[model samples]
Target: MTTTPEGTPTTARHRAPGAEDALPVPAAAGSVAEWTERYAHAVMDTFGPPQRVLVRGEGVYVWDADGTRYLDLLGGIAVNSLGHAHPTLTAAVSAQLGTLGHVSNFFASPAQIALAERLVALADAPEGSRVFLANSGTEANEAALKLTRRHSGGARPRVLALEGAFHGRSLGALSLTHKAAYREPFEPLPGGVEFLPFGDTDALRAAFAEGGDLVAALFVEPIQGEAGVRSLPPGYLALARELTTAHGALLVLDEVQTGMGRTGRWFAHQHPHLGGGVRPDVVTVAKGLGGGFPVGGLIAYGPDVAALLGRGQHGTTFGGNPVASAAALATVGVVERDGLLAHVTALGERLRERLRSTGNPLVREVRGEGLLIAVELTVPVAARVAADALAAGIIVNPCTPTTLRLAPPYVLTDEQAQPFVDLVAALRADLAAEETP
Candidate 1:
């Protein structure tokens, strides 16, 4: 067991023994090698091999089974809003579970209703806005897809998605995704989905100009997370809203990666500095919604859009479980009470400034708003940089061969963040030397 900052004890979870682990538990139960070998046989080969056996996490740091601690800059791909083992989050989950845990869709819990209200308010959506709970980001997008199709009224069936966009892995969400590798395996996906050049206003205008009437909705990520944290060009979102509205197409903003303060705003599209002032018909969010508690949501605005999906249209058994809802409620409460949105905004600016100030030869560019950032490398050695970063006790993700993504938890301190810039500078020098003749 590990103790949280509030002195609460958290049970460290370990994988139960499969038939293969019958040999015997190692004296060091946290040994990475022993656990890695067991994982290879029991788990599917989808994610290749496990990166490391993480035993415990507190704040912005996690300890591997080997007892080596690393600053978790990725934050579970932008899911841990409050960092790990937060007392507020823990207390909320515990108290809710003790009172009422899981409830069927037929029944409703206070947390379920309360969380929906909170999200609707946070969005500052128009009156009559509604929310649909789900288990993950993919499910949230899946529900949004169905709602969009229903709102299409059968006359408009074509949907527009940005190139390199990753909505989710479900059939409906995948249809909106543009990655060929993810979509190729599931051939002949749902038809009428069109791909547009990301950040290209002309392409967006042209697509709608050519097939405005046939288009049902246009899905966009305010900041493309998987596409290397690429933010849409200035006024791009506004233009999208104008074009979609003129064409009678609904603007569905996918905030799965940029929502819940990831971009220092409740929703990136709502950030005025990032080109807010535009309202979307549908917005899908997850990742940081439950603060690592595994919850997703679809927030629809306006009465017409909200009523698109009536009763019996769609639902989920574990969508609004009391435990998950309570977790989300507490997550939002803490973010608001602690003023984390403003904190994130300030911290993100400092991080970006420090990185750019390094003037490291290897770092080409650093881009992103708030905490959702990407450091573009001068050479395609991001994978190597990431590996070296791990060795140096810092965690980050190589989103592509040339792009390094950082989405550390909201609780990351300036002291912790400052050193990361220095680490990268040192790592870059090493990498540059290796490439030199």
Candidate 2:
């Protein structure tokens, strides 16, 4: 049995030991089809059929079970910022785990305290901001939602969320999420919430006007990731902040998908278009924060609202696991030390330019900030295009029927982006041709 650098045990338990290294030259039996069949039997179908059973990854490239190498443009749905098995993240997690793996919330570890300090510092908010760590993006939002209520003293408990916003799937987070399909079946959710059209500052103002002090918070995503990387128009977030502040409501920015340098900024709201030099009261982050190790946090600014959650107000068993904190610290350090934020900015501009240059009639629009990007096709064949791209040895995501999203690792080089762009262009052409007849 061989262990990954992160100390993750890799044995024949998942597949034959060393089988990934000895993959066939031209083709292999361990194709997506074969591995997908095995996955179906062994794994739950929460995320649907496997697009590809990726067995190995390095930087921006991943090899599927079939030994087919593909440029991973999706970056595991924007979680692997430094790409798979980054040495920094691996070493941090391994060393921290060896020294201290986990401790109950009753007792804190240095890694956990350090991670919280780092996140709060990175937020650059006032000195009194506090942090609550969680295990996933949903948990972060859930914790933040609770904090909002605690601060409001239950008098103002209603929340105003954006129409296309995706906070999370947990009960509390789902309360703020606006998708009918995701929310309807799980009705009788935590109550007192309203949804408004995103980027419509007028509508947001109207909602607060109607609700008055009843609104506890306005939860929003600086850039809607699950909604096909949709971004708010300039000054929308600033307007929300102003309206919420005027109404004595908290402005919660859900940066689960847009934070951690994904959008060339520490937080997407830091963008000139979004916050316009404003600061939000609450910010929730996850995804790339740990660079693949699950870690999420909620940052509450100022003492007025920071200490709302007193003892026994909130807790989690594995929220601030030492190993997870260590992983996040390492990720943040690398991002800062290597200056990846600027890298993402430059590379994102190049990627967007190349994608537009494809000039395919099917591409209706291409939009996104930094490494997080999306291409909207005129027709609703994004799933087919994604599949075609996979077949052509490239990986991307069909976020909507007509929109394809790409969130490649920050480590992705221009050389990697070029071929992937070419492959997407070719796939668009092929799909267009197939539809012509």
Q: Write the per-residue lDDT of candidate 2 for residues 1-437, one digit (tens) a residue.
A: 12356433222222323446764653345677877788899899888887777777766678878777888889889999988777667777877776889888989999999998998888887988889999999999999889888867879868889898889999999988988999999999999888888788778778877767888888989899999999999989888878878888888989999999999999998988777888999999999999999999999888777897888889999999899999999999988987899989998998899989988788889899999999999888888888878888888899888999999888877766787678657654556557655
Candidate 1, superposed: residue stretches over 4 Å from native:
1-28, 429-437
Error of 2 at 233 (Å): 1.1
Candidate 2 accuracy as lDDT: 0.85
Candidate achieving the largest TM-score:
1
- Best lDDT goes to which candidate? 1
lDDT of 2 at 183: 95
What would the per-residue lDDT of candidate 1 be over residues 414-433, giving only the tens digit for each residue?
77776679876775456756
**Steric clash pairs (candidate 2):** 30-65, 30-66
Cα error of candidate 1 at position 309, Å: 1.1
